[model samples]
Target: MRSPQGVCLFSLNFPPEPTGIAPYAGALADGLSKAGFSVTAHVAHPHYPEWIIADDYGQWTRTEERGRTSVRRRLHYVPRTPRGYRRLLSELTFGLRLIFDNWRYPAAIVSITPSLFATALVALRLRLTPNRPPLIIWVQDLYGVGLAEVGEGSSLVQRIVRWIESSTFRAADHVVVIHERFNALVTQELGVAADRVSVIRNWTHLADPPNTTAVQARRQLGWPADVILAVHTGNMGAKQGLENIVDAARLAEARNSSVHFVLVGDGGERKHLESLANGVSHISFVDPLDDHDYHLALSAADVLVVNEKPGVASMAVPSKLTSYFNAQRPIVAATDRAGITAEEIFAADAGLVVPAGDPEALLSAIQSLCADEQAAERYGKNGRQYRDAVLGEPAALAKWSDLIQQKFRDSNQN
Candidate 1:
């Protein structure tokens, strides 16, 4: 049977790209496909974690099947700079590349953020097209606020970028954010109607259920059973406020607690973080693992971590929390209690929350959990239960299905 005229979904990150938004984007695509929309996913060539495009992909506009959807990769720039003009250029370059990614007039254009340029292109396409298919933006990060975090809001480039962001939000028929905080920003601050916004949290993308049963994953990874392993998985970027983890690691070692800090992922700040931990005995860094190993390792850890920079509460919600919930480990979120991450963790009764960027407070919280096995176990259980209740695949997919179909009146319209 032929797939119906469906949705054009564009995201900057997709499968084959490790960390960041890839897993979330890919999961959403599959969910939409399962909802009966023929999805054509437009993504730039994979270049994440290591920030180098693999030689084999995008040799000539490669196309591949991902369940019911088809993904098209276009060669786009991946700049080496950690920040500044070059990085912005890379984002814009990919956006420009997406302009030609063709599809039937999709009932709706759904874009996941960091796809700002591509999303703007969608707005422009709506302007050019006759039907003006509804543009739906799932904002994983509010670029305007995030750019301001990096001190880019005052720049001329940011001025133009914000204008485009406003246009994209204005063009969107519906706006999705993972947190209520963000919903408020998009509605009250950005002028999107409250009724048009939806808060849908992200979920783990692993296809397989937990499988490392009976094997001691910690022993396999050389972690001592006696030591309390506090593991943080996913991107090591500025927004993560991982410097606090480094400081907390130093404090843990100085106090000589059996608690050890393990960071299992890489990104722009990986090099600098390594430099900070050069002589630290209790802190270690591991490369990103395949899904099985990563999940098993996370499940084995005594504590899972979510850290965010000071004052980043309203700007972004760490999607890593969904993965953390899947890991079913007691969480230690060293962030503002009022922030989205802390709110979720607290509501789920999943973990302990400490003040953001406070080494002593983080150390105290880790030690508290390490001392009470029963409390930690309860927290872990709570997190797993919360994932089932809220962030599970069925719930997320159902929401997307309704939203996607809502963009069109009739099946034949698109």
Candidate 2:
């Protein structure tokens, strides 16, 4: 069935991209379509964690039906800078490529962030076309801050990108941020009006019942029965302050031999992290697993980790918190700014938040749970309750569907 309003969703990275936002985009597309909105997802070929294009997608031209959603993939340049510069190039190319690809369809648009180029281009098109549909710019990561963190671009380029990003934010008919802190940044830093912006918290997909039997999971991963399993799943990059985790592992080992730390997933800092823990028996490094396996690993973990660099508050919001919440495990967030995720976790009594990059603090938080089984159970239950109440798939879909359809209706009147 054709949609009442043609709403096209554009994202730099979509499904098979091996990260949070991609899958989130794909899911949103499916959800929006099921709500009776015609959804066409425009994205670049999958190429994330590895920084190279995925082999299966070839150079270009891949399409799939995700429920009622239509996904269109296109070819774009992937840089070899091995850091932020390459990522900037990827976003730029995908943005430019999508302009033509999405020209005729999609009466309204919603864009995910850090893809400043994509958002800016869509904003520009809307500005130029008087009768064009309204655009919603979803701010996930603040682009200017993220680029500087990874050591990308010249002062001039950073200045220009910031300009483009700010202009895009201003251009959007509505700007949505994942948390209150980010919403404030858009208003104070970028000068977006409070009335024009909304704080839409991120949500987790409805999770399956926990695997009551992790005997298979434990056997497959060789997790020791006696050891306290501490797992860090997600990107292994500089921004994550993974070295702090390695140091925490050392401290955990020094404090208790039975506490084991496992690092799963790959990124720019993988080699250095592996090298640091080379001879260490307590800290284990495993290859990145698929979503199902990742979920299983989280369930098997005694404590889950989220970390950030010192003084890097507002630089990023870890997308893994949703997964952690869904996994219903006690989380230890080591972030300089414990924004919404940390606040909610604490309020729900689901986890402990420590200052970012402080190995001693992280070590202490992990030990708190290691020593108290009742506290762990309480925290885990709180997390599950929080997830069910706020971040579940149905809640998110209902909110998104209303917002998108409202935009579609408004666009039609215009």
lDDT (CA) for every model shown?
0.79, 0.76
lDDT per residue for candidate 1 within 131-179, as digits (tens), equals 5667789898887777776454467776787777777887788888887
Write the residue-wise lDDT of candidate 2 on 379-412 in tens digits: 8788888777877787777887777767767767
lDDT of 2: 0.76
> Estimated TM-score per prediction?
0.92, 0.91
Q: What is the lDDT of residue 135 in candidate 1?
A: 73
Candidate with top TM-score is: 1
